[model samples]
Target: MQQVFFRLLGPPEIYYNDQPIRIPRRRSRALLYYMVSTHTPQPRERLMNLLCGDMDDESARRAFKTMLAEVRSQLRNIDPSIEWITNDEDRLTFNPLAPIWLDTEIFEKATANRQSNLSLAIKLYRNNFLDGFFLKGSPDFDAWAQSTRDHFQRLYMLALQNMAEVYETNHQLEEAITCIHMLLTADPLSEDAHAHLMRLYWQTGDRTQALRQYERLGKVLAEEFSVQPLATTQELYRQIASNANTLTQPATPLDRTVHPPDPPLQATAETPVVEVRLPYVGRVRELNWLKDQLLGHEHERSMLMLRGEIGIGKTRLLQEMIEGYCTDWRILHATCQEAESKNHYHPLTEALRSELNRQDIGRLELYPVWRAQLERLVPDLFYTGATDNTVDAHHNYTGFEHISDSSATLLADALVALLNQLATPQHPILLLLDDVQWCDKGTLGLLAHLARYVHRREVFILLMYSPGSGEQRLAALRNNATRLGILAEVELEPLSRADIHELVTLFSQLNKPGDRRLHTIDRHISGDWCYQQSEGNPFYALAWLETVWDQPETFVPARIQEQVTIQLGQLSQNARHLLQLAACQQDSFDLAQLGSQLGFTLATTLDACTELITQRLVVADPVTTTSLYTFTHKTARTYITGSMNRIERHMLTQTASRIADPEAIS
Candidate 1:
């Protein structure tokens, strides 16, 4: 028979062969109380103190020895062979290793079992810890005692409810009903317990009993708590009442319709940011080349220059590389926008601030920290502070002068210092500077300084620019950098028709067969259209598509006409006149001869070519130093020649004839 582990969260009691062992002497029980309550093996010295916490040391030790003798006599009645305690006097150790069961341990194990296996968890919590037991004022023992029972009761009730849910889900109506009954025994007023009982009653074809339980529960709540049954509780009661003969269909789905598939999302849906994945279009080969350049090169400080005309897709190439090719590298990007009319170093400021903020800068002083960087990008910025409304000392320091020659080097050093500080540890930095042509001289100088350390540090600098606009500055910088061994360039070409068609097919949602006319337009026009309208520039093509796509069904031709008219209206008078003269002549024309034919000054002709190129109406030989230009697209040439009036057209031909042979018109 196991001796019951007695605790005095209340007064002490014992069990032998599953029966209580009554011991009447209160002081003898106190000795047993101290030993059982504390698991630590108490020494003779500690036991003496427990027996008398405040008596003289000698008297306390004597009293504890006498109490131990009494406890041994009581234990002898259970069995003369039963030895209740063991002691190692040499080590001052006492240990109780007998087989005994404690209510607190039972309660805890039951709680754990309930979580792992509900049935066992429920059985273990069949009754409160030694029901009707009590111990006055040993607060530590009392709190531990009551807390264990309370936790067990809560867990047992929950276990019964969960078992009911599992049984109901499995259509085990009788078992589920039995589980709820067990729950009601423990907590007769648990609303959920009753509600689940009602559900089980209906499931088991006992609708009358289910309705009766509901009424009983409702009355209990109203009389005891002054509250009516919840709507769900009432609805469920009504369900059971109406369905007298029908047992709940066992095969019915227990859950509601599968939640609609969550909308496809990247990262958290609450964030407003969206990322665009650039498609691999016509630049597969260049992309491969770029991949090789980025991947095969292990050395840091490698630089790649993508040089092209304004609309020629330099930016797109870099965007593609970032999305598809350069996953292994850490890309930090800054784009120079034509919209920003502030100082040249403004782009650099935006870039620096974005990277710093992305790195989560916390409360940094601007004067020496950010100001030092600002000085490098705009040296004159250091000289001018708090000059304009845009320059608030606390928010920013922007009153600097234009970065002249004297401050350029100082600015470079500051920028280099800032970059060195910003670089993340152990990561290769790929600095992408798009539209480098638009970058101010100060920013350009900073980039030049960055290039100097590119080889030494773990950094790759990629710069994309238009040769027409940036060639001179780029050449000067490259020539200077060449002496230091860091100059390279790559050029982009127009996408072939097949590639353009494939891109439209892949990116645009419009059905190809349904919108054959538009498809035909795209097929015929996308190839040379960008070349002609945007000098084969990807940005212009994308922007132009945004304007012309999805024309109204009621006015398809009208939409096309409107678009053409809008673009024609935007043409400068000089470009319109020169385009008309070129239309009367041939597709390709010498600029000097065209100027003589139009009876316009060479400067006027040059300005007209500039307008056409700026508007992307024509393409010039990007490799040539001269102003030799041609119609960028067949449509532009055809539009001008086909739309010209007869009289103005004849005058253009005669002007061309006279400009070719001076004696003819004279």
Candidate 2:
């Protein structure tokens, strides 16, 4: 028996006994491709509508029947013994048990199980789905085909990424480079793939190639998106450039190549610590204020809230303050993760665990009763000989019993006592909670309790969170702390253009001494363009500068545009659509104009715009007579426009262009 093979990844084709079989009609080929790709029973009416919707209903029915007949006739001629299409009264499906192979099916199966046959999957994705096979007058079929093409492309890219990571981990530098190169070819604007390729080149002892890759990435980004590389990517490039010689140097061959014996590990009381190394750029005043409050003679306990936008350096500032000012204090730090928000008292539990692990448990002698109560929170602390009898019987009796106010109060008091027992006047405690916006309600309540009693102890609490995210909860906590004279709020503003220039200059001087490249870069660097592009956000500025600094000419890099797109991708579909519509209005668009174009009410538009403002994607003009808003950066506007397909852009542009007459409103 001869096998039948169908190729649908590119142009649809079939082969019988290694001989090509002609698929005569465009509609017949499309029908075959759709049936094979979907691999399920498709309603005959739906298929007809998708393929021949532009025709009259009777004509479309006839076209669909004729197309199905042609497809069946071609299959039967190729393989008379095999059942190809299973036709019924209302639906049509390809026979699953037929002795036929499809490129799309094989590619999908291989990519789906890519962990085992990633190389094979990568090889099987020969081209885009049904490449150059457009059914004229069939918009629905074209749309479906385009979407399917994008899906398969993403899968292929993911497979390549996975293969690269695996190769890099196994120290297969050349193979990793090959995989990343292919990924970049598939999606040239992928900053991540470019970064990986740069790193792989550096690891393979090719410093020049690494530097060239960065330069090429910047050039490509500039040409394609009129944007610079991301600050993170630029920073990586800088690191590679600065340590080129060190990175490229070949390792000395070992004399005997003897494997060293595994050393015996000693048990220690200290938990391993992860040090955060963020560049300390701005926030001098904030740091100074925190230092004074933390180290001042005022005996009252203080709570300082460091609030800012994401990547605006709140966490970095906190880390710097701890290292610079809180050296003499015993610090217990915990970061509330977004994923673990549902875990009650998560941040508090982490802080307690870290503190307990750092200290000798035998030294602190708690009352048998308090020890048992503490065990309720930290079960592992007394894991060896602890009993569950400490749990209140009444609390556990009802399986879903709500924690009573008194029980919560008791738990908070026990937590505070544990902190007090660990701290003294000689060694004050600094409890640092990072990303407090994600902290659970129970953790916030515990902190509130601690704030009320903090005046009696030498402990200082530091909470860091993005301002807009946890507004209501943080405001409530702030009010309580303010009433107690224990709260201080610090809002971090974006760096001034001069400040950004200073930061860039400092980094360049430290890393690339005596290099004249800074002079050329600094000329463009001191302009308002960089400041506006970055919105004075240090992270954004750094990212923008790193990519454009090498080139004397100014152009927006791909990294900057991609970053905005990535941020937008995280928003709700409605919010994202609203912003995209807003982008079509160009610079400094009025809310009324946008609402008019979208056919949305003024209030609904305002609500969506508020989300965009909070994200720092757009900024409302404070001095405008009308309600004017613009994207925070031109790069963002460009990114939004570039992300849309031709049809979407045309539709949005036409709608926005029609709103020439501004509506007057109160």
Off by over 4 Å in 1: 1-278, 298-302, 327-330, 337-344, 358-397, 402-407, 424-426, 454-457, 504-580, 601-629, 636-666
**What's the C-alpha lDDT at position 664 in model 1?**
88
Q: Mind giving the per-residue lDDT tens digits that candidate 1 earns over 1-666? A: 556555432334577776777656544565565455434344565445434555687876676677777777767776666566766662122245655665435434444442356776666553764356543322333333343344445546666766777877788888888988887787777666777777777766777888899989988888998998766677777667777554342211122112122222121111111132335568777777777666665434356787765445565566667667555555666666544424656666555443343122222222122333353343322221111112221222343344333234435544554555545435556777676656666566767777885434456678776543334556666766667676556678877666655554554554345665456555554544534443444544454444444444222222223334444565678778887887666556676677666678878978877766665556775556676677665545655666778998888888877766779888
lDDT of 2 by residue, 1-666 (tens): 676888866666678878898877888888888777665566787788778857999999889889988988888886777778997778788898888887766666675554678898888877877888998988767766765676567667878987887888899989989998888888887766777788888888888998999999899989998999877678778889788454332211122122222221111111111122336776778888777777767645567788776556675676687677767777777777666676767677666555554233435644322343454555544332111112221121221024434335545656666777777887888788876877877778879888776545478788877644344566677778888887877788888777776676665665465555455565555646567667787656666655636643335565565556545755666567778877888577776667656777777776776677766677776567677887777767776787799998898777776664335321
In model 1, state the lDDT of residue 133.
51
Q: How do the predictions measure up, each by TM-score? A: 0.44, 0.52
What TM-score does model 2 achieve against the real structure? 0.52
lDDT of 2 at 327: 71
Q: Mark the regions of model 2 whose C-alpha exceeds 4 Å error after superposition.
A: 1-279, 299-301, 358-361, 365-370, 385-402, 455-457, 513-524, 527-529, 548-570, 661-666
Best by lDDT: 2
